[model samples]
Target: MKKMSKLEAVLWNIAFPGFSQLLMGHYIKGVLFVVLEFVMNVNSRFNQAIMYSFLGEIEKAEMVINYQWLMFYPCVYLFSMWDGYRSAMPADEKYSFLPFVFCAYFVTVGLMVSPKVTIFQVHPGPVFLPMLFLIPGLLIGFFIKFLLAAKLYTK
Candidate 1:
């Protein structure tokens, strides 16, 4: 089987968790991710929250959201992307996992602060707020990875 590009794998995973794994022929892992995504989405009422959040019904979105289940989303989603990217790359060109690590951390922090944060006098709501925070997370991850790579190469 022909190998996929890292970007392609990441994009496929973004469309739906496990898709990249499926393309990579990791059937069991892919199925598990898909099933978990479905279960978590249903239990968390994520779609409803997204709808309410988009409609600017912050309170309604919060009310319908299941925080417990919702918390699992960032980790799973980011991990899938990381795993996909890692799988697609050549072994010797392996990248650090710092990006995924920081993304999960920052996303969780975003979730925690989402209720209290307001950007530009507007509440970002749950869905969008975490996404916004992801930018900073990615930046931090890249910086750390750079530092680590520099240190390693200097040795």
Candidate 2:
């Protein structure tokens, strides 16, 4: 197997849930992710929500969104990126899952808070708000990873 770049895997996954898996040579996993992505997107009316949210129609976006289905997205999407990155990298890499795990957690929290959060009295709407939360989540994940590395190295 040719060595693959973890960054490349992450970028592919960003483009589409399963694309990273495909790039990593995990055909079955990739197809499954793609199928899940399509199913969830349709059921949650995600694209419609995005369109409305981008247009500043917060109410319409909320009305069209299926929260239960939409909630699955962050976990699935983040997991795909993590999995692809993990698959491409050496197995011995430490704490590699931290960022993706925390990002998923934070994004979910963002999704939960999307209805009430506002910046300067302007609602961020669905997609963008959760993304904003991801920043903190990623930071927290890296922080934890750093702590773990320090502890392990000192031992």
Candidate 3:
């Protein structure tokens, strides 16, 4: 099989599972991707349960649920997409983990405390209703990002 450049390999792998390794001429990475996908799914579910258990405490509940989705999920998805896209470009770009770390703390802490500053609210339900929407929404976002990346990167 023909060899693919770094960028091509990353993109193809993102779009089509194992496509990247195929391009890089590494069949093993492609196969391992199947296992990686399963691990990620299981991990996410476990995290969801743990986060949900925090619901007993309103503050903690909002903190985990909102922070996970509104902040954590989007940032990760965007970063991955950007990384994958850059990798697919003619010249491969190095992955910088700093921005991701900065964003993680900034968004998580920001969202966690932002609600306290709110002036008013109509519904007094202990649990924030929006959490219902945000939780599932972010999960969907991840799935979408993965699929999009897969599409973009695959040859």
Candidate 4:
């Protein structure tokens, strides 16, 4: 199999969690990611929620979403992106996992609050709300990673 570029890996993983792994020839792990993602998608009623949300049926979308199953999504999804990106890199970069980890954490928090939280009186629903949280998560994670690296190097 041809090695995927880091961007290719991340984008593929974004499309589906394990595509990059499969492209990179980590068959077992790739299959596992796909399976896990499928299971979560099914149990969470994610697709149904997405459809309803897109149709402007916010209440129905909220009603259909299974928060328990949905909560696991951010962790699995972000982990796959991080793993794919990390695997594609020729050299290991320390603290790289922090951004993904924090993103997952913030996304999960966003999911928890999606039902009640709104910005400027507008509800972004389950999907968009969590996505909005991703920015702060990434920023905080990268900032922390940078500080950690600086501290380690300056010592």
Candidate 5:
């Protein structure tokens, strides 16, 4: 029997993005990234709701947290695809961590303070506090990948 070509494999990766990466042998990178995306998606949903409430749009925030696809899922999936593609790249290239960090900070800030929506509600509960840990955790993950990139490519 004939075997599938590399292009076919890469195209499969595009379909699910990370699946092909796993098939190709980047299990650590692919699995971890998929997990990270899932965690962030959940966090984004929770925070997006809180942010909406802070902005005084309780209903909108609630709606977003409960069921807003346009706001979060697509973004997270795209990010996963990007990461998967990156992981699949030749292991001798330096990946930039700055862009990811900047984007994360921007989103956090936007959630915390968007003038278009008035933040009339503030929740000082355990919810807002978790992000204090999550932000840094996400950054650390990004840096870990950056380190791997540098280490792999530096040689």
Candidate 6:
């Protein structure tokens, strides 16, 4: 099987979770991720929400989103990305999953509060709100990972 660079793997998964996995020949996991993504997307009306949000219709996006089903998105999406990234990483690489995990946590929190949270009187809605929160989560997670790797996080 051909190996892919970590960046490529991550980017592919970001485009659609499981693309990297499928390309990397991890058939079962790739198929599973694809199936789950499909199920969650359909149930949550996520695509519609995204379209509405992109069209500057935040209220319509919010109305179309099924929070109950959408709640599962972050974990699955981040995990899929992580799965691809980790697989592509060198054997000695450590703590590489921290950013993805933290991003998932923050994105989920963002998703939970997206409906009520407003920034400067603008509602970011389901898609953009969670996406915006991802930046801080990545920073924090990377910071923690660095600390852990440097032994600065002593018990």
The TM-score values for the models, in the order shown, are: 0.95, 0.95, 0.30, 0.95, 0.35, 0.96
| Superposition TM-score, candidate 4 onto the true structure | 0.95
lDDT of 2 by residue, 28-105 (tens): 999999999999999999999999988889889989999999999999999999988988889788997999999999
**Model 2, which residues run further than 4 Å from truth?**
none
Best by lDDT: 6
| Worst 10 contiguous positions by lDDT, candidate 2 | 1-10
Prediction 6 TM-score vs. true: 0.96
Candidate 6 lDDT (Cα, 0 to 1): 0.95
Where model 3 places Cα greater than 4 Å from the true spot, the runs are: 46-155
Number of clashes recorded per candidate: 0, 0, 8, 0, 3, 0
What tens digits encode model 1's per-residue C-alpha lDDT throughout 4-102? Answer: 999999999999999999988989989988998999999999999999988989889989999889999999988989988898888765346898889
C-alpha root-mean-square deviation, each candidate: 1.2, 1.2, 11.5, 1.1, 10.0, 1.7
- The candidate with the higher lDDT, 5 or 6, is 6
- Across 1-155, the per-residue lDDT of candidate 4 in tens digits comes to 76878899999999999999999999999999999999999999999999998898888999999999999999999999999999987785789889999999999999999998989988989988998999999999999999999999998
> Which candidate do you rate higher for lDDT, 2 or 4?
4
lDDT of each: 0.89, 0.91, 0.45, 0.94, 0.51, 0.95
lDDT of 3 by residue, 29-55 (tens): 545554554454354442443455454
| Model 3: per-residue Cα lDDT at residue 18 | 50
Q: In candidate 5, what are the lDDT values of residues 23-83, reduced to their tens digit?
A: 6576876676567555655765755766765666656764565333323433454455545
Q: By the lDDT metric, which is better: model 1 or model 6?
A: 6
Backbone-clash count (model 4): 0
Which is the better candidate, 3 or 4, if ranked by lDDT? 4
Task: Choose 2 or 3, whichever is better by TM-score.
Answer: 2
Q: Rank the candidates by lDDT, best first.
A: 6, 4, 2, 1, 5, 3
Off by over 4 Å in 6: 152-155
